[model samples]
Target: MTRRRVLETAAFGAAALAGSRPAGAAQAPNVVFIMADDLGYADVAAYGRPDLATPHIDRIAARGIRFTQAYANSAVCSATRTALITGRYQYRLPVGLEEPVTTRFAGGLPAEHPTLPGLLRQAGYRTALVGKWHLGSVQDYGPLQRGYDAFWGFRGGTIDYFSHRGTDGKPDLWDGDLRIEEVGYATHLLGERAVRTIAASVKAGRPFFLSLHFNAPHWPWETPDDEAESRRIAGSNLRHFDGGTQATYRRIVAEMDTQIGRVLDALEANGVAEDTIVVFTSDNGGERFSDTWPFTGRKTELLEGGLRIPAIVAWPRRLKAGAISAQPMITMDWLPTLLSAAGAAPDPAYPSDGIDLLPILTGQAPERPRTFFWRYRANDQAAMRDGDLKYLKIRGETFLFDVVADPLERANLKARRPDDYARLRAAWDTWNATMLPERPDSFSETYTGGQLADHFGAGGAPTPPRPALAGEAPR
Candidate 1:
């Protein structure tokens, strides 16, 4: 048998040895999935960002398996989230094609679709989402309609950390679909709400699935003390193109880590730390100030940095402390992986493209090789990671690199290894054929004027007329 076949066989054998459920999982485990917005692969200290101190996020790495090769489904927010909640490729659904469900576009996660929290709730678990919900608006595609028993967060992509205003500078905070006004930094509020939800779940004697999606270190670059900065940027370009310094960025990330510490402490205080599965990762790669070392490209690109993310899984009952796995996994994998850990399965009608990772994570099976494909409407980017080799096509240019040996993706092995390149390219074409095609009017956020020059360098081509977000001030 080939090396890949041997590894697959061994993985299957290990799963068989571990039986149907993860060892030590006597009952359904509470799940706390923490997702950071625009966090780089090296954003966390454990992932190799020496400048920042993230002890709380580091604590999870110290206690469980750290995935060295994890990727987000898309390089953007809403698309990756679509794959995350559905356990399938984002391209499968119309909403997933948003690139990101930005303002002006009314794209939203369909309520009829089977979601992670929805399935878990059906399997006797209480589900709550206590952070950014970019899936859709509350009037139509709200989280409550998508399987979450309770939802307490904003419904847009970017919101002011202090004022809690959306991209359009309107109040976007919510309490189970009802618009409400509250005070404090968005990160702290979301974190504290998660703690309360966990406590409530424990008191009620039911397993809980808490999706804590934090919109930190993303844009406007406002720390908790930057409420004044929020006021300065309100009603203007919420993107804050000319704002944020590295020091301010550091403070933002540090504050997120602090809130994460609080959530960890809550689990321990509730005496369910051992019975809970905590996962920490990012929605996608970072932007301007993110430290995506040893990798090229940033958010909105099909490069390694744009797709790679830090993924840590902690379960005291099933995972060993300080363990590291170089398993190639993705955002959608969480749905099947967490569901398997909870003794639940994906809906048969909507089969998951991801595999259950509980067996491999618990050391019951060897890591198996997997192929992953990615595409972005911006820059006409398309990429595929098959084994160690990666095929990339962007701006109508094609290149190949062995991402394993060259994580930076500097070498072009296309001519040297023409066969592998052709193979992967063909594979990507086949996979892409199965998924929905890109629409003619699909929205992709492109740079303009000086920003275009800043992103694409001098003499860059001008972009098409972009749709103005509702209530956004004209430049």
Candidate 2:
């Protein structure tokens, strides 16, 4: 559709929606979107971790549906978050193309862009974000400027769990644009704030959309007991790749799960458990000390492990409990799904790249096939999934796998299934043509000496960084 026609349709829809009350505004389900950063597909006990206990996370699975084929929009946090908020492919916007946005990145989600929270707010829902707003800087682009009515979080990718400082040695904690200092572990602090938001929303008798994005099991590898480790890494980088152990990772995940339990408890305490819609998932794949067993490769790779995530949804009022679904879904699907449940819709001017999965999720429809595409400039990597078949290309090698049968991606069937392989490859090319082209100067996560060796093999050479594409300034 033409841009002008789309905008005109959007204007008409907005006017019509404004004049009418939401289908069930008085009893609209309160949405609690809880996301964990860099959590592996099997990190929680519910998914299949053997060494850790995630009773709270497991509880969520038991209370609702668990999706085995869920995926993040990107292999990185910021990119996936952009898709989540905008309900579109991350590549559609310059800001989403950052791979993972950094403080040096020059753009963010445009304030004028239609966002999940913004649309929900217009539908008579109170919106708040309690943790991790890495979309952009607080100075120019922030949660308040975008969609969130109340924001209490940091504007960085990862922060010191105890000190709440960014890797740049700057205090990154905030209370709605104002930087603030709070003495506590970042995970616990965010959880506490989220509970408070829930309480406030309940008291006000308004349906709320709380985005509880947590930076857990992501980096710095510090639990509340690791304050000394936090102090040790204070002046240095928060990536503390040299630190962290399986036990430490366990503790971090455990703490996050505990905090989630608290948030769930608050819902029950406020007598809204059955009416609230709670979604628990991850931003991307896991990092070091993460167990993504059965799926080879980790974050940044286009492998199944990097893209697949654990997704659980609980809304006792509308969804059946303890259901398991094999339906393939991506991060962008959430916006349209939640909006449908709330009696709202995406802006017609920017139609969602995702479909409303509410019908399928609520058992109103059967499982269906889906097509997805992905690309990462670092290794010249690209991937496409069409049903059970996946076509992957990294460096200069091509591979075809039935990911449904070989979750480990150990078997390549390109030679045997040439036709299917060629079809998927062609489909990827067609889809890529529709999205924004990759800018040569765009920044992607890179590794140094030892890190390069860890990622590649010993004596491996790193791909040199490139400047921006011709005539295109870095976003």
Q: Worst ten-residue run, lDDT, model 1?
A: 457-466
Tens-digit per-residue lDDT, 300-329, candidate 1: 878998899999999998899999999999
Summarize candidate 2's per-residue lDDT along 49-143 as a digit string, tens digits.
99999999888889999999999999888999999999999999988888777656767998789999989877767789999888888878888
Q: Count the backbone clashes (under 3 Å) in each candidate.
A: 0, 2
Please give the CA lDDT of all the candidate structures.
0.85, 0.85
Where does candidate 2 stray beyond 4 Å?
1-26, 447-449, 452-454, 458-475
* Colliding residue pairs in candidate 1: none
Q: What lDDT score is found at residue 272 in candidate 2? A: 96
Tell me, by lDDT, which candidate is best.
Answer: 2
TM-score of each: 0.91, 0.92
Model 2 worst lDDT window (10 residues): 466-475
By TM-score, the best candidate is 2
